[model samples]
Target: MANLLVTGAAGFIGTNFVRYWLEHYPEDRLVGLDALTYAGCRRNMDALRHYQQFQFIHGDIGHYENICQILREQQIDTLVHFAAESHVDRSIHGPDTFIQTNILGTHSLLKAAKTVWLDEQPGLIHRFHHVSTDEVYGSLGPEDPPFSETTPYAPNSPYSASKAASDHLVRAYHHTYGLSTTVSNCSNNYGPYQFPEKLIPLMLVNILNNKPLPVYGDGLNVRDWLYVEDHVRGIEKILSAGIVGEVYNIGGNNEWKNIDIVHLLCQEMDRAFAERSELAARYPLAPPANGQPSTSLITYVRDRLGHDRRYAINANKMAYWLNFNPDIAFASGLRKTIAWYLDNESWWRELLARAAP
Candidate 1:
């Protein structure tokens, strides 16, 4: 059985990925490391307690020595790096954390991996997979093609810039130091266990509470959305069959305008509340509970600073090389996501409470 180390294992995508890995590779021992920052919730991984082979470590990736010790002790054959300061608004407000965590933290992890996997055990079979985003390609025009592996780096936000720097370091490690590494840049992801700060969850929560659903600018900015499970499958394909030192773009090929997505969520929430009689009592604050449309809560707000107009990914490389493509459609995925939040009220409620200042 393979031993794997997954950083950022308490965050949205990382939590999902860790659960996915344990479920599929129950024989494989997995160590999950997270700094447990605001976005990284330890409770998100509570379900993982059932997996005897899985362990969670509350530690910052910025510490190189700690990482080295973990690698050496765990005998981790694979390191999946996912830790990053991902929220755009937060990055704009506090760029220093982004730089420290995304850039320096990644470098520290790389160094630790190099020390343990390459230097200490020269011939060890190891893979260092760096998870990244499509924002590094900067904004795309209305007619611009989707971002590909060959796309040039033109990061517009502090978050994306830090990610770009980390991506460069991963590349350098693979090329300059001959580390067995692969990078996958994915599009937007949405599904269960997602923190409410993101667009989809935020809208869902606000609609449930009758709070204003803030839509940025005219809300026409576009983004490709990938289901969380499909992203896990794509990452599995890369780890299994992908070429070392190569980059793959994972996308759902599902593009939607921000306003359109908000409207869709409103409609879905209304539909759910209409079909479920008990939902009215559970979420009494919702507009649907009062026989009003959830759409009534939509409120246009000021645009974010340096918000990318569009971001799309070209996953042809993943398809051609790894035979991987996202499976869940936007409609089906949205329904599942809505159902998750509605059913797991306690989970989200506790999360919101803890996150509250």
Candidate 2:
């Protein structure tokens, strides 16, 4: 069995990736390390509690000794790094944490990986895969083409800036020390188990409680939305077949403005609730009031500071080189995602209760 170390395994994308690996690659032994920070919870990994192939470690990557010890003891051959301080609003409020976690923490992890993995044969299957976001490309004009692997880095926020620094470190390690490494810059991801602070889940939670569905600015910010499962699959493909020192962009190719996404969610929620009410006699939780439309809750709020105007990805490299394409379309993916949140309120409600007041 291949021993794999997954950092930040309790966070949204990290947790999803862990679940995907455990279910699909039964032969692989997975070690998940997470700090269980405000955005990460052990509950996210509840389903894997009974899996013999999985293990969880609670630690911070910024501690080099701890990370090195884990890598050495676990005999980890593959490192899939998903740890970072990722929220833009939180980064805006306090950038120091972002710098500490995203930049210096990545540096510490790379140092450990280089020390441990380089001691082996010159060319082996050992790999370090870095997960990043498309925000590192800054904003795009209305007519500008989507971002590609070769796009110049022009990060606009503390979160993106820190991630950009980490990306640079990954490339430098590959060129300078010959560490086997690959990086994937992905677009916005949404689906089950996501923290409620992000746009989609936050909107869903708010609408459920009859709270304002805050839309920043005119809600015209464009993002390429990739389902969390599709993104995880793309990452797995790249980790297995991607060339070392190459950068791949994983995107859904589903470009929609923020307002359009909110509107679609509203419609889906309405339909779902309507169906639930029709089955109310059998399902005690269903109510006639559940079918009431909820779109009237959308409230336009002040635009977030330094919000990127547009973000789209050119994922042709992923498709052409890796034969990787997202299996879920936006509409279908959105419906599945809505159904998941509707069914799993207990998961997100706990997160909200624990969030810093």
Candidate 3:
């Protein structure tokens, strides 16, 4: 059993991973480190507090001394990097944090890994697994094939650019310095504990509250969606069996247009609300789409600057190399996601309150 340092363990995907890892590998010890940034919520990881094998560190990955000390003390044999400034819109307004965290912070962690794991124990097996995004491949035309492991980097936005740079750094460390590493660039993920600012949770919350559902541009942009739990499974697969010094692209093979997803979500919200509302007395029979249904909440807005048109991942390599398969269908995943947000009103409410102006 490995002692793992999981950076950004308080964030959406990281929290899911921590719980998943602990549940599956009860013997392994996990050290979760997060700075609790705006996007990193401590409550996301509250359950892990009771797990004796899991410990949460209130720390930053960017700080070299802090990371080196942790690596040395915890005897971290593996590092799973999940920290970053991930929002594209936020990156457009502010790129500094992305550079500082995704790029520089990655460097610091790599340096610490090299020092504690490599320098001290020269012959020990170590892994630095970087969780990245498919956005680094940039946009694809309607007819373009999905992005493959060997696809050329064509990052479009500040967020993707930062991730691309970080990917390069990981590759460089593997080749030039021989630090064993694996990078998996995954498609968009959705499920429990996602910050409401994201499309799925945001639309769900808005629909329940009867607020306007903002759709960017014509909402025709397409994305490959992976359920969050399925993604955590993929990460575990990579860490256990992925070849060192190789990059893997994890895709759900589930693609949908933004508008289509919103429409479906609207309909699902109507169904969910119908079951919960005693005052409205309109639960089972969904309201007409033309009436004041959730779909009616859709309001078209300006498209994001430098928004990519489409993102589809070619996971054939992951399939062949690791037998990785995404089991959750989009319809089932969407329904489950909506149910989660509906049941966890206090969770989203408190997070939104903390983010309020």
lDDT digits (tens) for residues 1-357 of candidate 3: 899999999999999999999999999999999998887888877877889999999998999999999998998899999998899999999999999999999999999888887788898889999999999999999999999988999999999999999999999999988899999999999999898889999888776666788999999999999999999999999999999999999999999999999999988877766556641342223343224677877999999998899999999998998999999999999999988886787888888898887
Tens digits of lDDT, candidate 2, 5-30: 99999999999999999999999999
lDDT of 3 at 214: 96
Candidate 3's C-alpha lDDT? 0.90
On TM-score, the leading prediction is 1
Query: If scored against the real structure, what TM-score would every candidate get?
Result: 0.99, 0.95, 0.96
Model 3 poorest ten-residue lDDT run: 282-291
Worst 10 residues of 2 by lDDT: 279-288
lDDT of 1 by residue, 50-119 (tens): 8899999999999999999999999899999889999999999999999999999999999999999889
Q: What's the candidate order when arranged by decreasing TM-score?
A: 1, 3, 2
In model 3, residue pairs whose N, Cα or C atoms come closer than 3 Å (at least 3 residues apart or on different chains), thus clashing, are 274-283
Q: lDDT of candidate 1?
A: 0.94
The residue pairs found clashing in candidate 2 are none
